[model samples]
Target: METGIVIGAGIMGTALARHFLKCGHRIALIDPDEAARAAAAAQIGPSEEFITAPTPEALPAAWGPCHFVIEAVPERLELKRQVLGALSRQFGPDTLIASNTSGLRAADLARDMTHPERFAIAHFFNPADLIPAVELVPAPATSPQTMDLWEALLTRSGKKVARLRADLPGFVANRLQHAMARECFHLLEAGVIDAEGLDTLTRYALGVRLALIGPILQRDLNGIDTHHAIARYLYPDLAANTTPAQVLDDKCAAGMLGRKTAQGFYTWDARQERRAQRVEALLPAVIALARQIETEENDDAEMGEQARGL
Candidate 1:
């Protein structure tokens, strides 16, 4: 069992700790907040392989040298740099250092590190335990060994790894997400659709289609020529705002930050919260079905090719 240290005891960190423990790996969760540590322990339940410490200095001697460290602290470049620098000092050069940043560049984070080659990005989605997808991005200075190490580790741990060729802003997933979100918010501002209609449209249309086949593959099946034509017609009319949507800004300004605050575009009641939980709970099954379908399609194509040869 590999020994992993996860810094930050927030939702993503706690989920990652639990996931590692479930994979029969030893994990040390570090957070300065006593309350956050307590809450994480409670959420994960008692496990011999799992432990929590307020800092790396407090880690027990029995945990051994960390094989990997995932820094899941809040999204701030300077804070991440500080944490990573400290971790680099604490651990040897062999230990892989990864960030769970949603968008920050790995090269920028490794700028001040002693061993830039050992650092990379391993961005996990929320509810990291349930989310099967992980975007692995490496810094320009990051060694191929580091990328291979993380790819092997996460894949062995049952993650669907998307190794990005280059570290760009927001990586792959978030950029696609925000692009769609931009249009959604733009439609909202234009009074073309309400929040409910928007969710309904996305849930039934984009979500369902994209779940089975990725956008590129779906476009191929739909004829890329048609997609190109549509894009040409739609591009000019789409939202091209370089700043945050005014509606989103106004909502944040009013402290109506969605489910956490019980309001945003819509007021989230207990029932709505339960529905949201249900959706997340069902995501794994949906992803499984999508994979199964993809496999079957590939098999059918192979069989067809064999028949044609015969």
Candidate 2:
């Protein structure tokens, strides 16, 4: 078991720390505010104990030698650079440095580091304790051994790890999401659909279908030739429009960009946070359903093979 130091006690950071602690690793959570640290720790409950460091400088002294250090601060390049630089100075060359950046390039981040070989991106989805996917993006200078060890550590912590061969902007999920969202904005701007209607369509149609079979698999099952025919018409139209929709442009002009600004596609209310919790609570059951479907399919395949004596 490796000692872990997680910097930033924000929502995602605290959630990840709780998950790691559940896996029985000693964690030192570093945050500047004592009240924030105490609140986050309390939310994590009494089962797991974490040492708190009031600042990044205090982490190494307080936690001793940490094998892994995770930076989950805000999406700022300079802040991440400073934290990683400090950790490199504090720890040995063997220590793994992971940045929980969503869309940032890992190679760009590791450029100024003393030990770039140990730097990698361990991008976790929001509400880390629930989401199973963790993108393990290794920089060009990152050592193969370091990448392998980090992957193994995350797997042991009960996350499904996906290794990206290249450090592209937005990685995988965000790229797909942004592509869809761009079209969504276009539709809304054109008055093709309202927010509630769009949400309903996504929840009922694409969401349920994607949950059962992924895009590629679904295309295969539905006949790729048919997909090609649809794509042929859709692709040209999708590619033709590079301009952002005017409605979004107007919103930006007015300074409303979702929850951060308190308004965008939808108005923000504090109750939405509670609503999100209720939705997240159903994730485990949803995962279990998917697992059950997979198991049954496997069993059916085995029975058919036994019957055929193959």
Candidate 3:
């Protein structure tokens, strides 16, 4: 079994370490914070293949030459660069390094790295263990080998690998998500829809369909010409604001942050628990249906290729 070193003991880091353990990799979880490391160790439980340390230097000498090392620290460019630079020197040249940054560009992160070619972004969504997809982004200096290695590793871990053509900021998933959020916030602020109605529509209508076919495929199914026509009429009316919504700003100013503050767009308490349970129940079912759809599409493509060959 290969070794996987995960730096930072935050939520993403611990979850990723857990996933690596499940994938049968020897894991060395490192965090500078003693308490954070302790918390992660507790969360991950005890395993012979697993070890925790305050830093890579603190770990036992034999953990070197790991297969991969992923940094899941805070989303600061300089901080990430510092961590990665140190790691690049600590590990062997063959050890592929990755960042779990949500938005930072791969190019920026690799600028000062000791081995830029082996570094890339393996952006995992929140609750990494549960998320089935991981975005693989490579910097200009990154080697094709690095990309292939990451794709293979993530695929082996049961994650759908999405390779991007360029190292774009915010990447694919976050850009799409923020675009939707921008529009949603604009609509709410304009009184076009209330908070509850907005969420209801998103949960039932948008979420259900998107999970099955995704956005582009859904557009094709609904007819791109129809979408084009509607866009012509609606584009001008859509939100073009570069700033955060006034409603969201006011809520933040008042310290009414969601869940953490117990209030925001909605009050948290029993509803939060219920919502969490509902999502936990629904997501696995949605993932199952999506997999079935993908298989059918693949079968149809194969048949088309066979027909052409005949």
Candidate 4:
């Protein structure tokens, strides 16, 4: 098994480390806080043997010569540059460095690195252990051999890798999400629907439909002609703001942005926390259904090939 090092003890980073341990990979977790490290260790349980480095500076000396090093730090450009530069100096030329940046350009992130050729972005989704999709973005300087190796490793670890051609902000998924969110905000600003109603509409209608078939497949099933007609009519009224919709603007102005702020679309209190937990509990079943669909597709392809041979 390949050895890996994950920097940062944030939710996503800790989850990645836990998943790596589940896959039987040797892992070294680099985080500054003792409490955070203890929390992460508890999450992984006592059975798994993994090393923890107390600081970023200690990472290089403690976990050198790792096959893969994933920097799951915050989405700050300078901080990532500093970490990558240090890793490039410490690790071998062949060590693959992956940044878990959401929408940042891989090329820009790798620009100051001494060994940019081995650098790439492996943008894993929230709750990394549960979400199987990972965006594998390569910089222009990234080597083909390095890309191939990391792709294989991630695939073996049960991640669906989408190799992106362009290093656009928000990559692919978040860009789509932001676009939808913009429109949702615009509607709320116009008083078209209440927050609860809007959430219900999405959870029941859009969410269920998208869960069964993705955007492209849904478009294919609905017929592109109908979609084009709808798009032409609705496109003109859409909000073009970099920020979220007017309802969100009002909320921010009033200092309500959800659970964090205790106010936003919906009012948040202890009761809201319970509601959130109930909503989140539905995800595992949804993921299981998605996996079943994927397995059926694979089985169908295999049977078709066998029939052709016969």
C-alpha local distance difference test of each model? 0.92, 0.84, 0.90, 0.85
Report the poorest 10 consecutive residues by lDDT, candidate 3: 276-285
| Residues 51-147 of candidate 1: C-alpha lDDT, one tens digit per residue | 9999999987877788999999999999999999889888899999999999999888887788889999999988899888999999999999999
lDDT of candidate 3 over 163-255, digit per residue (tens) = 998999999999999889999999887899898999999989988887776789889899999999999999999888898888888999999
Runs off by more than 4 Å, candidate 2: 59-62, 239-264, 268-274, 293-310
Clashes of each: 0, 0, 0, 0
Candidate 4 regions with alpha-carbon error over 4 angstroms: 56-64, 243-257, 260-264
Candidate 4: residue pairs that collide:
none
Question: Cα miss at 10, model 3 (Å)?
Answer: 1.5
Best by TM-score: 1
Looking at model 2, report the run of 10 residues with the lowest lDDT sum: 236-245
Candidate 1 regions with alpha-carbon error over 4 angstroms = 294-310
Top lDDT hit: 1
Per-model TM-score, in order, reads 0.94, 0.88, 0.92, 0.90
lDDT of 2: 0.84
Colliding pairs, model 1: none
Candidate 4, lDDT over the whole model: 0.85
